[model samples]
Target: MNLSHPHSSGTIVRCRRLLEPALREVVSGLHPWGARMVAFAMGWAGLDGREQDADGGKGLRPAITMLSAEAVGGTAEDALPAAVAVELVHAFSLAHDDIIDRDELRRHRATLWKAYGVGPALLTGDALLALAVSRLAARPEAMPYLSAALIELVQGQTADMAFENRPWSGPDVVTIEEYAEMAAGKTGGLLGAAAATGVALGGAPELADRMWTMGRDLGVAFQIVDDVLGIWGDPRLTGKPVHNDLRRDKKTLPVLAALASGGPAARELAAVLATGAADEESVRRAAHLVEEAGGREKARALADRYLDSALGVLDECLPEATELRDVCHSLVDRVS
Candidate 1:
């Protein structure tokens, strides 16, 4: 069953309708081979280059960018450049992540690196990142925010990869504080840029800092919710195999929380992880251990806390942020 959030459904639909055309136009301008790979990656084209009316995710980042502008008393059109730029950056990251994770599928289809060769797919990601930065050239004021966000994004991804190599039961373990910082870098940085750029475009340069705070908190909440889904979400909804993160041995927030508990269940969970290859039964047992150790609840509470902070900042900075708040709540409550 689809997760329902009646208050935000119509708004989400409207935002996607407004954002799709702009995204398509930007993608259509890429070089032929690069365009084909990216289009395939985005579900907009088949491997054979036929057109497809694909469901290109929730368009959450772009929608948030546009909404941020509206919150600052400006029209959605004012933030279009920032919205497109961030969307491109997001796609670029996904293309690279698919390669890094060795993920064969994304959005229920073959990943770019799987369909095309890894070399081409990597180049396609590079092209997309270049396009994303180039798109901001017209808005010189937005450049600094995007540049800083990109740097943090790279740093976060590097840390995430390094975390995977650390022994699950070793002394040099990943801590909750370190995980939070990585989450902020990997996920929150771009979100902060999106809001800040939108605010600047909205003619409220003074409120840009506040919007960055809102975006960063929301981004942290977003990653936490994503971590929850990685462990417990239905495969039909999330478009991946069941117990996906466990199978990959990803060091997500829930798993880290379980490991930190130092209780019997947490110990068992760590032992299971140490085995390295997480078959279905092992994954199921590990997930149960995480829950037994209160990891799931702890992760949920952390997500809610960040979301509350984000909403509080939104309320203080923009009284007219009802739509944005609804969207934020809906995102945090998402199952997929």
Candidate 2:
């Protein structure tokens, strides 16, 4: 993290403390029991699914749901069930992501796929998905929206996987569109679902549309920042390759925009991406391209843009939950 962001640590601690327990309750007690049971399916036994889910990263989606609910004049207690539903989906996504990416680490530990292999990982993810449905069914009133959200989540993952199978990179026109679509699924879709669910849980059907838009924008901003850190962040902090995104030819917002710059950086980025599945040498070379192409500055600007827009929606649509305004801002400003 930039030393300049003095208050980031405190804010992260505060937010996590406020959110962690609530997440635990929902998952442990069955936020959506159907989904948790899915996590426990026979296939999951081969993969250590329960352990991974239990020891996963921050429960951001569910926390966001609870915060949104509270910000909208609803109680955290009322939002707990929905929170569980949101998190079950998130955990399943992560497990699958590990397999698809062939990644070994998550939350600084061996990813499910790494420990159990792709087959078990797939089974684990499937169980969790089924459990999510079960949890939604438990809340008959919320089932329709919850189930729809889960479907959307799957669609997003599908799009993401489809893009990874393609061979291309950098800010070429096709690459840009593909990257955006991939991100929309892998990132934005879930946030949209969570926000929409929050509105539904709060009995604010009229506001679900607005909240969905806000959440989508927030997801975009969140992803942009993540890409930045994936490239330039502290290795000690993020625990991944310094430029993992670059190595994957990720075509992230910054890299794309930089490629769009049509500068020397763009040329280098294009060249490196043109040779996909890079090694450490090539990854460093591609990052140099990002810097040369003005990617860093552009990524920051794009992230700020969506964040600002989301904040605007929050102000207009969630006036009752004014505290969330500050909290969400902190999410953007904080360096992970």
Candidate 3:
């Protein structure tokens, strides 16, 4: 979901100027005809599709690419191929994620599944994944790290499906530790891989995993911000209605905390979330009840904790990673 005011437009512009040319050049150089075919399949046929999915992202992966290169004394230009690959993989995930979550709108328009239909969306996602691998493979220096990143990225997706389908058969109340574990697989997996791949591209295998973990921690914080926006964000900014998360009966940090608070609001919030029995008024009441029960405060605090953890990991993992470290700080400290 788009968070209403949190996107850093300035940073995004910087990323675009840094990434777009490199992405295009690498794609063209790799397997000319094949790359265009894959892009067409993924609905990147023109500016519209590209902007809808790829253009509007936070550029976290691109940031990792650039920063990792700098961390190891490589120019950002040298890491363009890897950066393009990271963006492709990230785009693939978003396509499938929208379908799985049944979110009709993306970047304020119908998602690929809605616009072109599910079959196309699925095929497109697969194509993008293949394209990402091809980009990495085409660049010899980035291959080793790229392979490992793919493994973790795919495994994380598996873990995400497992979480939604079975949920560990535990209490409905999502624990902080449990949420962190899930976030690692869902968000951390790709970010970690992207960061580590950058490190490897810079010829520093010794620091790859450390870079990955740093990215993972940053991703966890990012996910927490997402959960917060899912529940309380302005509809105008994020392009999702209030209570969308509650409507889906999905587990989020705030909802889980409200459930565990043991109060009337917590009790009612639990009932409504469990059965989806509420009308509009009822949903409003449940939200109010959750705040009365301290869920709001708890969610904010949890987000802060993860942010701290991510910064701590960055400090330790990349002792000399100024560029990477700066990007990490910027992402976790955002308030838009």
Candidate 4:
């Protein structure tokens, strides 16, 4: 689970090197104002337009894209367009997600909307998405997956936002099954597209469907791990305030699983959540109850299950892709 293991790290670094120039070239097509905003969003520069070594992201999506191509006997360069497209889509999603969630911090810094105005940030997100689409507009083999991802992403985001209005318990409560579907869409779609497009562009078009399914399962696992971290991870690493999800009433997997236990601790946790208070002590207590009710353990088990499912597909389709497997494993095992 060492994400920085030499092999996987080398793969990521190599893919990133290939992706950066192309990403920069595409982003450079924007107007200066939009370009500056995008540069900030991509962590290439600070709000002052000075370059800073910020946490851009793991570049995992693009890495996955390139590796999928390589796994199928195609050079990483063959999937470069797909890699860059997924990365831009990722950035676009984050820019809009921050605005939708009203989250001010991301990757240990101010979010795009926080640094820039919401209107500009929204437009910048649109611009990034447009560039992403343009990258593969002529690639009929890969474009369909990206298009489907956009649809799924929107559907998932809408469902997640709608969940906020649902009851915390009883018949109308958001179920685990529902959460899985949402995660598969919101978080998994782009990952799926990355793999699908990779295989498609890599001359293994027939394997694209299976890889898409693999990425979706991986996405669910990734999202569940993210839920676990949002509640318990150190802010220094996660770059998010403790209990921020709880404070926002986010329908996270851990909290939902905890409330479903139907035990004493679960009952207590329900009462705490029903209070609708976001006080530090309350949220801390809620987090403790989630762990006490075995929510964290359930979440971990579920993540492992999904990760295993994804790896099973990888094994069947591309057994030689050891580095790609490691990267996928690292996604669920990541601390940040």
Candidate-wise lDDT, in order: 0.84, 0.66, 0.67, 0.91
Clashes of each: 0, 7, 2, 0
Write the residue-wise lDDT of candidate 3 on 78-178 in tens digits.
Answer: 67777878888887787788888888866554676776678777776777777678877766656666666667656655655554543312464446677
TM-score of each candidate structure, all chains considered together: 0.95, 0.81, 0.82, 0.98
Could you give candidate 2's per-residue lDDT for residues 1-336 as a string of tens digits? Answer: 232344334533454565555544444543444334333431222233453433344456766676777766776656666766777777788778777777786544567667766787687677666656665676655566566566666776676556555544433354555555556556776777777777778676677777777877887787888888888877666655567666664557777778778876687677778787377788877777787789889888988988999889988987766455655665566556
* Sort order, lDDT high to low: 4, 1, 3, 2
Instruction: Give the number of the best model, judged by lDDT.
Output: 4
**212: Cα error in model 1, Å:** 1.4
Q: Could you give me the TM-score of model 1 versus the true structure? A: 0.95
Quick one: best TM-score, which candidate? 4
Cα deviation in Å at residue 201, candidate 2?
A: 1.1
**True-vs-predicted CA distance for residue 219, candidate 4, Å:** 0.2
CA shift of 66, model 2, Å? 1.0
Q: State candidate 2's TM-score.
A: 0.81
What's the distance in Å from true for residue 99, model 2? 0.7
